[model samples]
Target: MKKYQPFLLTILLLALFPALAKSEVPIQKGERLNLSRCVETALRNHPVVQGARDTIRIGESRIGQAQANYYPQVNWQTDYTRINRSRTGNSTYSDYNSSVVLSQTLYDFGKTKTSVNIEKLTTDSFRQDLHRAETEIVYGVKSAYFSLLQAEKNRDVAVETVAQFQHHLTQAKGFFEVGTKPKFDVTKAEVDLSNAVLNRIRAENDLRIARVGLVNALGIPSAPEFSLDDSPLFQKEKIDLADALERAYRNRPDLQSIGKKVEAADESIKLARKGYYPYVTGSAGYGYSGEDFPLRDGWNVGALLNVPLFSGFQTRYAVEEAKASLDVLRANEASLRQTIRLEVEQALSNLREAQERTEATRVAVRQAEENAELANGRYDAGVGNPIEVTDALVSLSNARTAYIAALTDCRIAQAGLEKSIGKRD
Candidate 1:
């Protein structure tokens, strides 16, 4: 993976404006955020998770509409008429009608039942989608958090380097005043100190940019200034590929969602086939009709059966469509499994590589620190040159940077593995 450029640029702007390094948007003491808090905030506020939840409610409404077919439908109606006739002695008369009618589907060969089942399955699928969205946001927060930590560490390294160079410049000036060191040594020390100041400015810029990225990941792009606590950078985690693969297969919400869709498609196919059978409907009504109010009353009930003969093969086409949808879902399920397997493998590879890099950089940091100390000691003893000290400091800085990068990579890789296995928390 490419290094997190946004986080790394946190302090670059500070290089251009050195005064801002000291008072640059100080982080509030009470604004410190941790990984779990960030994840929770994102889940509560992110639009993706909110949309997924809304889909669940939509699915529930569809289920209610499907079930309405099983209940009796009632309607109340009224009509009035007045007529004046010229052909039979010109008589005026009035007629009134009022009625309440109820209709219900007695049987449809389980068509309504199948539709309800499909809706329920679809709702369950969307519930799984919600889970997937939460998981993705958690991983994103973890990545940003780790990158912020890395950038902070790098800033500290830059500060220490500047201090070291300042100390060297002071010593050279002292020696030059006493006529022990040449003018070249003092000039070299001055040059090194200037470079260290430049680096420190860049590191400060990186810290600011990193904070912005963390805020974005938390789903609060306009959040106030904040900081993070120190976290262990080299904690090794042991994982078995076989076990991870099994967990991914069982727990991945996206895969389970696709399976639910396939089941719903099967139900759709059954619903379409119901068109081949006859449907029974029954209706009942009560009414009063007369020239005046309360004149007469009547009641009636009836049942009807309708069978399909042919209608341009619409039923056949519906069944075919359902079958095709099922086939597509199955294909998607297969593709998802392959994708899950690849994710697990890639995460494992990244974790192992990061672990190795962390170890290598850890050793390098120790050696470089020792070398810098030795070089500085030699220069103090009046035998070493400025070049030796400058080279040693550069090596030490590079080692620290590499170690920080490696540690951040390790944390991100672990998060990736957890995501692949659908591990919450």
Candidate 2:
């Protein structure tokens, strides 16, 4: 029981960790997060995504205003006038008038249709913008997740290196007592052990920073004692190259977003051109205006047409502005398509390289393990020098680091591919 004191203390401290206020949401400390869950959490919680959602609602509301032409416009008014008693032949009489007026456009020369089209197109552009935000969140979360994993592995390596040097120091001290070696080896080992301890601290700090990034991505607080659960991130299925390319061309959100923007700009040009045509509208109003004719309250109906002969050429300038915008968006869209292809190409290339490296690194890790074991056996048998053992350990460390790096590179490449191709979830 005495030997378990530290373990018990650690458990007690963990139990004392503060929990979050939201019960439906997990207390963040000790939470296990993977790419999918992290992305989902971010999409649901990130402030940027929420702001984008608000913009979508704004677009939706504006669509109603653009479509309001299809419905009648109603106006209400009430007024009272007091006149000199002799002016209108009525004395001390309240001259009050109240009326409701309604007007509607029975027809317009494509202005209403084009305006509605532009608003709908604008809404579609925002839909793509939301997709872009979601994709960005996924990529950011993944990068932070991988960084944390690497930091953990680095920490483990540092600890193992420290233990190796401590063992070396112990062996040197024993050999020196037996009068078989000098004090220099022991001093060198102590120095290496101290450096390894420093390395371990740095790695731990790196992990903390990475955790902070992940917390930010998830819109949660940092400083959680979270355990990792990445069982899902490694789930893989082969993607047909042609299908991937097709999907990239079709579904890449940023590109689709640009495409929608170009369409919206085109719609704007049409909307602007609509002002060049005459606007024909039908209108009707009914009220009471009785001087003395049967104390009459009655109905009236009429129609009107509006044509803009000139207005400082504002409408003409607007058309030119819309056309210029259309031209610019078209050029930008062409550039975007090329950019998408380049990304797809680069991600494909990196993934292939990482895949090959993974296989190579797997073989290297195995060979290094064998070498380290042989070195250890030889050292115990007094047939190996300290330098040989250190070299073998170093080789093992390099192999392990390389293997982890290969896997990390593969995962990062996969993420880039996913983003390039717009693979949702």
Candidate 3:
């Protein structure tokens, strides 16, 4: 992925362009990707998303390990020993014993249960982590997608404005040839026309950069050309900040992950506490010991209970460690909740402010258009200086650009708000 300085101080920017955004190529006619398609493809193919999937699978594999402790352990042993005693006068004997001994923990006061619970919680935590990763990827994709769209639209506007300025420049020169307009007017007109061409060139470059950004966001191989499906992001909708914040708290996958972490820590505390209790085990075995040709058979079964008398305060320290882990998780959860609240509030404000700015900028564009027309008429009728016309033209172009910026801001803010809400995929 190409990186660029973030002039917008937001989530999107790039360098290194495909330069083929508008180039003629036989597009392979792949399925056009919208937000949903981008998200689906990213979930399936993105490295981060795939890595998260692997973690969840590991979590699943660990459940088997957690359950394996419940099964009995059986084994066989065989050994031969040579005995020589001075009293026996150099006599030697061989003894061998072989048997299958099965041993299982009868009880540990819910230790296994607690451990299983912790493992299950860990599995759930990773699932939420996957969801969080997918959410972030979605935001990245949306930002790049909208950026490309806006750049293309801006390029179209720049091209049209250049054509208009060139027509005006031609009219200015024709008037000059007739010995009516002054040379200064023709020079100013040419300068404006060149500026318009410069704007078009810049817009074209920007569009290419935006295309590179989209390609990176999609996490696909570098492509010469890619087309996104046309899908408008805007829709009129009412937002209830209160409800949204509440839902975000419940649904945000990162928070849910912390909650699971806390649960696992709690279970760990229980498992550690189990160390203070007695460990009970049941065992059964059958074996034969022979000193001669005939075989001696024997069988034994017993229950063993072991109480931790003292282990240099190991159990106590382990329980304390578990408690400390839980405390850390609780503190982290509190901090995370506060951060989520701030993000949601900021994104909401940005969206509403962008909405207002879009309206104001729309009016500004109309005003700038009127001002440009008035200046043009005044200049043509010999009541305005060429400088005044140039100023008005510059103002008009700036107003149009600002209007586009406001629209782009509104769309991006909306996407960001959805991210903050955590209901987005």
Task: Report lDDT (CA) for all predictions.
Answer: 0.89, 0.77, 0.82
User: TM-score order of candidates, best first?
Assistant: 1, 2, 3
Q: Write the per-residue lDDT of candidate 1 for residues 1-425, one digit (tens) a residue.
A: 34877665766776777767645433334577767777777887777788989999999999999999999999997899997888979998999989999999999999999999999999999999998988898888888888889999999999999999999999899889998899999999999999999999999999988888877877777777677766545566889999999999999999989989999999999999988999999999999989987659898899999999997999999999999999999999999999999999999999999999999999999999999999999999888889999999999999999999999999999999999998756
Order of quality (lDDT): 1, 3, 2
| Residue-level lDDT tens digits of model 2 in 1-425 | 99999999877776776342344463366666666777787888888889889989999998999889999998875566655677667565546555778899877788888888878888888888988888888887777777677777777877887787678778877877886766775676677668667877887898788778877877765435776665533544456567777998889877887787788888788878777778777767766654343445767688888887887888888999999998998898888878877888888888889889988999999999999889867866657667777788778877987887787788878888888888756
Better of 1 and 3 by TM-score: 1
TM-score of 1: 0.87
State residue 232's C-alpha deviation in candidate 3, in Å. Answer: 2.5
Q: Please give me the total number of clashing residue pairs in predicted model 3.
A: 0
Q: Please, what are the lDDT tens digits per residue for candidate 3 over residues 1-425? A: 23544554333322333444423432234545576776666566678888999999999889878887799989898788777776878778877777889999898898877888899999999999998988888888888888887888788888978876786787688878998788877898888889899999999999999988877776764544656764554543457689779988989999999999999999999899888899899999998889765769899999999999888999899999999999999999999999999999998898889889889988999999999899889867767777777788778878888877877788788778778878656
Total colliding residue pairs, candidate 1 = 10
- TM-score, per-candidate, Cα-based: 0.87, 0.84, 0.83
How far off is model 2, as Cα RMSD?
Answer: 7.5
